[model samples]
Target: MHRMPTLSLPMYDINHQATLGLTSALTTLLQQRGVPAEVSWPQDLLPHWRDDQLLLSQTCGYPLVELLPDVQLVGTFLSSAQGCDGQRYRSWLVVRSADENLTLSDFRGRRAVCNSNDSHSGFNSLRYVIAPLAQDGKFFSATRFSGSHRQSLAALRAGEADIAAIDCITWALLRRNFPQELAGLEIIGETPLCAALPLITSAKTGAATLEKLRSALSELTSEKRYQDLLAESLISGFNVSDRAFYDEVREWKDRAAALGVTAL
Candidate 1:
């Protein structure tokens, strides 16, 4: 069994306190199930998801297969968030209410913003949707990186950008906790649902401990005792994640690249 020094998982950081509260409860459940994992926070702005000592963490679909193939996929969180269906989720292309009459085609040559280039929800998904609409291998006149979903929303609020693709879970959490952030914003378009962020542990985790994690998470999601906690965190349940689930996500990335839609 790998020695799990800490469990660092902030699946949705917009309402980080809620995630913290839920994680604390989950850690207690893991311990009760003999995993003995303790919840901890990432030490840096960009989390080191590949850390050998990691017990469990959630990562975007893009990086899960592209960068961290060796990590053990525990399961996908079934979010109660609007764009979520079971364990799959999608990105919502959002614009201000002032632009409600405009459609995806109306945004051509418009300014675009995203959390980061590596982000599936913010970058990859948006690119995939816009690929077919791109002319001469371009769509948005300019692209901006806001560093996070909330920051991307901030850019739209301040008129720094016209459109941004935000993860639905982040949208739901912020809407529940801080409605002001999205006061004037409205979802205009969406990418197709694909594999969402799934909980992961280090590849070094042994089979026994892996089984313990699955059992604990299953109990946490299914039992009535933790219903309120799960609802507060916006997580509906959990589902088994086979790597095959991410095939289309990679295909989306490839399809965008083939259409030369990287800049969006």
Candidate 2:
């Protein structure tokens, strides 16, 4: 008997309950279709994407574009959240609510936080928005890398940073699950909409397996049990996607580099 393939949905694994619920739902759906999928969480996700057993996973647009040569594009998630429109989503530039008097220009020479240098919505998108405003390829007085969107928000809330860009889907999920975390933050600006996160598979994965995975994802909305899980996960549905869809992220990177603004 052949070994079953593996799945991982780490992008939105914010908490124990949410992650487990989503994993269980996905596992059951794939298994029902005779795919024999198992949910496996890795401490570091980048390495796992290259694993031979990787059947399906999700990754941000920035990394997706960077890894296009190594990974196969499967689909993109659609969210009912405000900044999301089908496969496209944007980021909210947030600051403390008390900083209502602050404007984008005022952010100059102030501390800024970013989730990661490699993130589209969290870092690259923000750099693109600030590129025009940047002077000498510099904007913030000091920039900090928080490593994750949640940590970036935490930095702002704790007064360690003046502003940060957060993915709209993550912002929506926090609003639903932990409203208090956002009580003190306000969205002062938004970036242009780009392709949202994409579902990925190893480049070596056969087309037949990819089709089975896509079919399983499409069935989520119609299945009652999975519908509830989708609601909890803030995932409305998935749309068929291809590598070309992520070219915009590459453009963002190129534009940022052209402007000499590469991080924060």
Candidate 3:
């Protein structure tokens, strides 16, 4: 007898509280339908990728596209509260107390820190905002790539850097989790709205299977028990979204190429 396929889903630590609940809910939902898919957090999912398993990775716009270039996205998901009003994702460029008096233009000649080049909120989204202001050889006098948003924020907080771009979603989460760390800084400006993170599957997955996955996601949070699980994880909801939403990121890539920040 042929075995039903298993699905693995990995998400970052910012949503660690929600990952297990999400994984279990997905696993149960798929199993009830005889699909036999398993969902899990990133660390759990990463080690099991070699066995022809289906993966459901949750990531922000930049890393999702960069980290799993081989995978085909099934759909994009965003919390109700995290959705923005336009193409530009709503994010902020936060700076330490010492730089509170500086303007956006003043970012030049200062050291700027970011989480990773693969981070949309950390890098790509902000790149679109900063590229326009760059001309000649002038932009940020120096740039540093921290590994995570928390690290980037800490760098600024400790005076190791002058400014960093932080997504509003993570910003709100951090505020709720660590108020004291944020008290020493202020948001200087908002970047363009960006596409939220998405749910992706490997290219080997079938179109019919992808449709079923989308349906499963649409219904995942509707049950009361699942809703409670989401609440504990700080997830509001995952709305149906598509790739066109990410075209703005491609636009940023163009801008990145134009401005010589081409490594993205």
Model 2: CA > 4 A from native: 1-4
Better of 1 and 2 by lDDT: 2
**What would the per-residue lDDT of candidate 1 be over residues 1-264, giving only the tens digit for each residue?**
655556766658666666776778778878887777756777552345887777888888888868888888888889888988887899888999999888998999999999988889999899999999998789999999998899999999999999999998889888999999999999988889988897888888888888888888898899998888788878888888888888888899889889977667
Residue pairs with colliding backbones in model 2 are none
- Indicate whether candidate 2 or candidate 3 has the larger lDDT: 2
Which parts of model 1 have CA positions greater than 4 angstroms off? 1-4, 43-47
Give per-residue CA lDDT, model 3, range 21-63, as digits (tens).
Answer: 6777887776665556754434433334333465455656665
lDDT of 3 at 195: 75
Over 4 Å off in model 3, which ranges?
1-12, 39-52, 63-69, 82-88, 259-264
Task: List the pairs of residues colliding in candidate 3.
Answer: 7-38, 10-42, 88-192, 88-193, 88-194, 89-192, 89-193, 89-194
Query: Number of clashing residue pairs in every model?
Result: 0, 0, 8
Q: Is candidate 1 or candidate 3 better by TM-score?
A: 1
Count of clashes in candidate 1: 0
lDDT of each: 0.85, 0.85, 0.68
Candidate 1 overall lDDT versus native: 0.85
Residue range 169-232, candidate 2, lDDT tens digits: 8898888888888878999989999999888988878888889888888887656767767877
